[model samples]
Target: MTTARLDPDIVARLVGDAVTAPSMHNAQPWKFVFRRADDVMEVHGDAERAMTRADPHHRALHLGCAAALFNLRVSAARHGLRARVHLLPDDSQPWLLATAAIGGVPGEDQELAALHTALRRRHTSRFPFSDEPVPDALLDGLRSAARWEGCRLTVAGDWHLDTLLGLVRDAEHREDIDPLVRAETAAWVSPAHATSGERRDGMPAEVFGPRSSAGSSAVRDFGRDRSMADRGWAVFEERPQLALLGTPTDTRADWLRAGQALERVLLQATADGLATSMTSQPLEWPELRWTARDPLDAMGHVQMVLRLGYGPQGPGTPRRPVADVLEIRD
Candidate 1:
């Protein structure tokens, strides 16, 4: 079958939607190159944006880029197009994460089209969530979404939830003692007192959420080294509804699959009127990362630890413009 020619304007617009995906510290670590000759948009991981101390192996970087690729699919479907994606198409060049070759108009995938509506709506929620339980049907839908991408979505239950929470706390302690990790986090998180040339990419002071006075750590501690006078305190839910995204393997392709699945779950949760937060805390530490896996489940490798609840949506973070991130090569 011959591939349909893609419109240049459409390529630009689809990439615009893709960059809205969330990344660690809002690093926005992705670059897209559209090859008009063969009709493919290549996604590349920008090593410059990689967090050296926090994510040395670039796993988080791959996840962020793949999430953007997922958004690209949503954008394509919304605009009546289809994207045929191939992960790590070139082994010689490891930085090239995937390539979504533009194809004919999108066919009848109503579910994918539906997620397009949530692409912009989904944001990380750092505020406190109410103790109310999420409906079983909604959680099941999210589980199915992850399963579609060859990953497992396991919801932590009872004692398992406590273990996950303790793991987060342990990760925080590790971050505290490691000066290099603290410095990396501090570099990305802006301080309230910093003079004018502040960055738009990292975690800003306004959305740091409140510091936990009761001693339970949030997924990530944006407030660890900074003191913002305007920030206020609130009580987090006693038991946070947490879920884990895992895959059978830890290959780069697996990371790519897990990343797409992670974004799908988040978007679905957003559409269902739920707020979400993610912590790679345990995943960041090789030793602690394995313990995050549930013994009852056959989840081979945990990719991300997610917190889902009903709470205030996180403030919208910044992104590099489509023009800056996407390039068209005729």
Candidate 2:
């Protein structure tokens, strides 16, 4: 079968759409290469950007990269092309997480292309949220989004909320003591530099929501270590509406699926006019990770803690230009 060559300009445009995906601390730890000869675009996890101290197993790294892969698929479909993906195609080259061959007409899967608009709009909102409850129907749709990707999304109830909030606090305390974890987070966040002068990757200080004087344990304080004095303070919701994105198994493939589901739910939420933030702190800890799973529900493994509500959307984080991330080869 002849593999039709894709134009380099089209590949770059699709990748620009892909790198908009969210990553932990906005690390943007992924790279893509398009093989014109094979019509395959390979996605790789960049070990240089890996959070060695916090995510030693590369779970978070995988999620972030897979999220980009999901975006690539979405972008392709929206452009009237289809993306056929293969996860971890070469075990010998472990960093080669996935490869997507782009060609053919878009699939009949309407939902896949539906998220195109949300791709550009979804941002991680770290600011305080109003106490308004999300509608059950919207929540259900988010849940179904995860289900479609072979994962589960469980909204925390009153009882579960308290437990999850405490776990976040515990995770924060761990970060405080672990210098390496603190360093990893500090390196990524820059509040002083404007977006124009900023690096291509990492969380800009503007997106780091104001430190809470109210002492909310659920929200993370990115300014704690960096001490951005200019960053103001705000009151996060007393009871934040949170959800757990989980998968039944913990493997490279499951992480990939969770990442896709995560972006899907986030984009859907964005389209619905909701702001979102996420914390994987508890999941970063081996001792606390298992307990993050809902007792009543068999979630298996919780991949991320999502905060959802009405609030100011976070400032858009920086992404490496398509030229930097995607390479073309014969």
Candidate 3:
């Protein structure tokens, strides 16, 4: 099969779709470089946006970037192109996370292409979810989505859900007291910066959702430190539905796979008409993160905790321009 060269405009459109993927605090720590001659797009992790205090090891960074890579693949499939992806292509350049050689023909990944409709529709909903449980079939489909990307998605049981909620509360308390951690989080979520349009990344006040009026919620309340006028409080569900995405090994490659799996599950959930949100708050701390996993469960290491139910979709957050993150080489 003859492969046609990918035009720069098409590459830009792909990158545009790629950046829409969710990230840690919406930090968007990924960059794309397209080689016109080779028709390949390189994904790189930007160290400048790294959460030094929270994610010193850059595990969250890898997850966020890999999510974008997954979006790129989906975009390629939707655009009648094939993205041949390689994770960590060059050992020498550790920051270069992955590369996708674009163009081979359409219909190679029809499943991925189908998820394109949900790309922009998926949002991190932090609002209170209804008590209605998600259908088991839908949950199974989400599990399959994760499995396709080389990860496992396990719906948390009652006991595990309670434990996970406690861990999240514990982590919240830690963040409340730790000055450095609070400062780091505060630096990323300023309403003034967002209002001025100076900052293209980070969580704005509008997307923080409401504070829990009663009962503990798995969603991270970003409004804890900042004062937001009229940020109404609502009663969160007593038994919030939660799912854990895990990987067998805890390596850089494993993190990348988990990231891809994370996006896949999220997109599938969105397509199935479920509101979704994720919390890495507990996972940021060593002790809390370790205890988040169930001993008996086959899921080796929990990568992300996801909340799925019926709720208000989160407001769209800002993203850096494609030109800002993408570089084209002749």
Candidate 4:
């Protein structure tokens, strides 16, 4: 870190790491602009890449982009720099979600830098997790991770978890019947590596994991319509470990906060040797979203539901090349 402007190469590297952050359907709806003059990097929500049907309010869009912002901060700290973030800095420019001014000395934030290792190692594990439970200590640490970003992480109890699973089923039924929602999801999913050319984004067929053989799947089945004869099937954990991330208020700023927290929790879980996957099916529907929350808990608006346990870390999903997602300006 120094008073001098950061190098463009370093900025590019930072953005490269940032873009690895997850998005719903792996849409990767984020863009980065590195202003070499000011040593600042800007993160923008890519409306074109947004899941318009599932996320009409762009709540998930903000979450995905903010996850990238969190990654940028982690990258900078790893490289002996500081990323000073300004959330929703420009009201007139709504899509301009955040800007990270880069500068500082070595060891700016050891905690943030520590998460750098998990950046690339962490992938959404759509595969089945063992029935082995996640220890309470690890879960507590994850809660702290979310709290550090001003959000709440509540691990659902048995009854609450069952209720969430029911909501997910309900949401899935609604998605099956709705033409627009189904089309939107299908558009972002690439079958067998890619139905098209070299795809830089979207959940590939290989990562969809084996279809749940049991009565109901705790995870979202992306390939429900596709034949599972080839993909095979497995019985998921009888009681899948679940957690909910939430904010006290539902606003753009709150969504931004929740996104960073979501990534933080995920990275921490990855570093802790836990496989993770995100489920927002219930949160995507307005009517069912509120029910996803625990009435006994104080969490306001639930942002994401996560499954965590020991299992195969799912293969990497495609991310847009840095050159495609990042721009450098003189």
| Residue pairs whose backbone atoms clash in candidate 2 | none
Residues 205-277, candidate 2: write the lDDT tens digits.
7777788877855767777777666888787788999999999889999999899899989999998899999
lDDT of 3 at 6: 79
lDDT at 95 for candidate 2?
97
For candidate 3, give the lDDT: 0.91
Model 2, stretches more than 4 Å misplaced?
1-3
Worst 10 residues of 1 by lDDT: 191-200
> Distance from true position, residue 230, model 2, in Å?
2.7
- Output the TM-score of candidate 3: 0.97
C-alpha displacement of 62 in model 3, angstroms?
0.5
- Candidate 1 C-alpha RMSD relative to the actual structure: 2.1
| lDDT (0 to 1) per candidate | 0.86, 0.87, 0.91, 0.90
Per residue, candidate 1 scores C-alpha lDDT tens digits across 257-329 of 9999999999999999999999778788888999989988999999998999898897777667788888888
RMSD of each: 2.1, 1.3, 1.7, 1.8
- What's model 4's lDDT at 98? 95
Native-referenced Cα lDDT, model 1:
0.86
Q: Output the number of the lDDT-best candidate.
A: 3
